[model samples]
Target: MIKRILLVTRGCAPDEFVPAWRAAMGAAVTAPPDVRPSRVTAGIVLDEVTPEPRHDAVGQEWFDDEEHLSRYESWLASPASAAVDELFGRAVERDATDIVVTGEHVLRGAPWFERRWRDGGEGLKHMALATRAAGLTQAEFFDRWRNRAGLVGAVPIPEVARGQAYLQNHPLPKAAGDWPYDAVNEVYFDDLDDLRERIAWFAENLAGNEDDLVRESWFVAVREEVLWPEATSAGEGLLPGRPGGRGTS
Candidate 1:
């Protein structure tokens, strides 16, 4: 499981920005060890400046469990948190126009839809993306999928401690002719440590499971507090160059 996911703000990041970001990342790495921090998943900084800032910071962290995530959140709420606050706070105060931050246990379901699409169905292709948000627990989700659908695949992130497991459908062919639909089930964990244990267990146990399930996936663990703001359709609030589009540079 990912412990802390940090979403730093950067509008026009070039190769030069990596060193600065790395320095900021080091701040997180140095936080007090009682947090029992493990791994951090740093996403490439995305640029989308609006008139006013709005969009949650996006990043991933793998922790051992739900308890760890909760403990990390406490430091975030406490004013005595750590130098991380000072480090990020100074950076944002000097560079960010505006910023907002929040944290929560997350469930991610990413099922690929592969296969040829029929000619006229191109316009409705976006509908296939709906499954990425399904929130399902471990036992029920996997059992249902295994018995009903003959699908064979592995869990996406097996490193997290407490989370649901199941296979996502990836439709192949890609054109308009094949039926395409994907499935997702996300079960939240208490913290990063819990996630780590679950992932390890899944990896070891997967080998002995039936052949029609995912047995070769590797789980990743990450931990790090983050920064972000509210998000709307076009970038932050609206689409630039459109009738009602609104956002920053």
Candidate 2:
């Protein structure tokens, strides 16, 4: 599938932000240049995570293939884009938001909306983004990126090796435009403490691995909400509070 990840920060209170964000997406699914995503997931950034000094939430949407992706991109750049932006502009810190189209590789469990990240939701999510190494092409970078994943280190990079959920997103050279990052790695944890432990483990054991596969990295934590295709059967649990609200459960 063709996936697009949106990193953004809240601009208002949770009450206002959640609803607005949901409404915008509800309309986005069927509106405009006739593009519709098969899946949509929203992640509310956790303050405890000390995000990359910018975005707080991560959003994901998936389409069928490159053709659909290209049409969606064209729609995003057209004058009609204003109407699209205005739909949920007030819900987030617009200027700080970033978007990228990628090819998603699911490396772990499914994404769910069972708990509020703050209230100890199903799991807190960590997103590690990076660029391909200086001398390697995207192909070579992706090939060697997981080399250390099976190494015999005591403190393994849980996010890379094992986790509640892991998604390796590679930014398409043409689809992602002039973006600096080439990959967005997502992993889920039990809580803040678990997140810290895993992060520390990576620093002590796997930081050096990046030197050969990636250029730099940025991390963020978020509480997610499964907005579309509501959990019905695949996920563990559904959002239990406000209709569009996440974590309230």
Candidate 3:
């Protein structure tokens, strides 16, 4: 599958922008089922943090492959699809917004996620915008970051026990050298406490390796709202469903 995510720093207030953004995205993704996105969710900024968090919201979409995404984006360029996004603007700050096309690697992935969050599968999400350490090339950074799976043994990653799902998303390079971060990582937890534990674990166990691999990391937290596919919801016993972000299992 192909994953595309848009990170936005809000210009319009959340109360006004959230719904408008979701509505516009819903309207724009009206492709044939084969090409339609399998997952779509809006991750609204959850806290007020330092450096002001480059993004206030995250719009994520998934498709079958590059071909499916191309077809869907081609449709998005059409007047009708374009019209649907007319309201999305102003809500998204033009300069702060970034759209990234990434290649994902699931470290610790699970099918059964115990429901600790009250409002459906909507839980605490953590995004780390990680930069490469010192002199390492992008290829070198990716190699060090991904190849550690072997050293970790049977478990996908150390923090898997605390986080329900853990993924590492590395952006494909561009000729312009515009996108700055080395990796955009995602972690969804049962709740804030679990998220805390996960962070603490990272700081304790992998701090050295992290220091060697990532020179800097800007972190953002979000409360996800699954806006598409009106259904029971994701996870067992939450709503009858397949998970899409905050969607299903």
Candidate 4:
């Protein structure tokens, strides 16, 4: 019954942070009510944004969890997540990842989405993606999640070259809009039939539109989440799932 989300914004410039913050905050104001209900809790963490040695920039996020992820999911899927997504687009150099936890909702979260750089390089990408619907056992879920998170260590991936290509080039590229890609996405559904239908629509409807700049894309469903009990207890106010920033761990 807890939802965790990690939004890593890669390849960002120092100047862009303020603008990105504004855009993200602005979107929060206009987000749809259905996607994210009122029960969720959120926060942001500014950590190191480099790969170490060279010390470059990495990803970040607008919010983290506070034992109210189900509520957060309601807000995320609601117009709010979308609004936050749009604001982030302006500030982020490439992309972000969204991790959600559910209690009452039919489905849960752990979907990862990356953004492409200005020059068409994969700006951001998902390192690991898993969910309850994906058939993850309880042990398997937490193990993989922790393993991936611990691997990054302190430095974050600042450029697209450091991230996985699937973040940018998946089955299709997602169109940028006022909402966050992870929120308002058709990926999370309890009904297998509904999930199948949506997937089919993307494949079939996306075939002829190769030339189109903005095409419908693929968003996977995440099944489970893991939280840092220490983070909350410490009151550091750090955002979960996001990587280190320029000077942070």
Top-TM-score candidate index: 3
For candidate 1, the TM-score is: 0.33
- Looking at model 2, residue 167 earns an lDDT score of 67
> What's the C-alpha lDDT at position 81 in model 3?
58
The deviation in Å at residue 72 for candidate 4 is: 9.6
Ranking by TM-score: 3, 2, 1, 4
Cα-based TM-score, every candidate: 0.33, 0.74, 0.75, 0.28
Question: What tens-digit string does per-residue lDDT give for candidate 3 at 1-249?
Answer: 477888887778666776655554454345556656766666777665324766778887777678877887777777745444555664676677788877777776545322322233345677888778899988898888777542322233454434677678877777686576778878787677677666565555554546777788777777775554434544432111211223122
- Whose TM-score is higher: candidate 1's or candidate 2's? 2
After best superposition, candidate 3 residue 31: deviation in angstroms? 3.5
Could you give the candidate ranking by lDDT, starting with the highest? 3, 2, 1, 4
Q: Lowest summed lDDT over 10 consecutive residues: which window, candidate 1?
A: 120-129
- Runs with alpha carbons beyond 4 Å of true place in candidate 3: 48-51, 113-121, 149-161, 199-209, 230-249
Model 1 lDDT on a 0 to 1 scale: 0.34
Candidate 4 lDDT tens digits, 1-249: 223333444335666554344334333323333222232212223122112211112222222233333454466566535545654565554334442322222122223321111111111211222222235444444343334331222333233212222221011112343122222111223343443454344444434432222223333322211111112333342132231111221
Predicted candidate 1, C-alpha RMSD:
19.3
Compared with the true structure, all predictions reach lDDT values of 0.34, 0.64, 0.64, 0.30
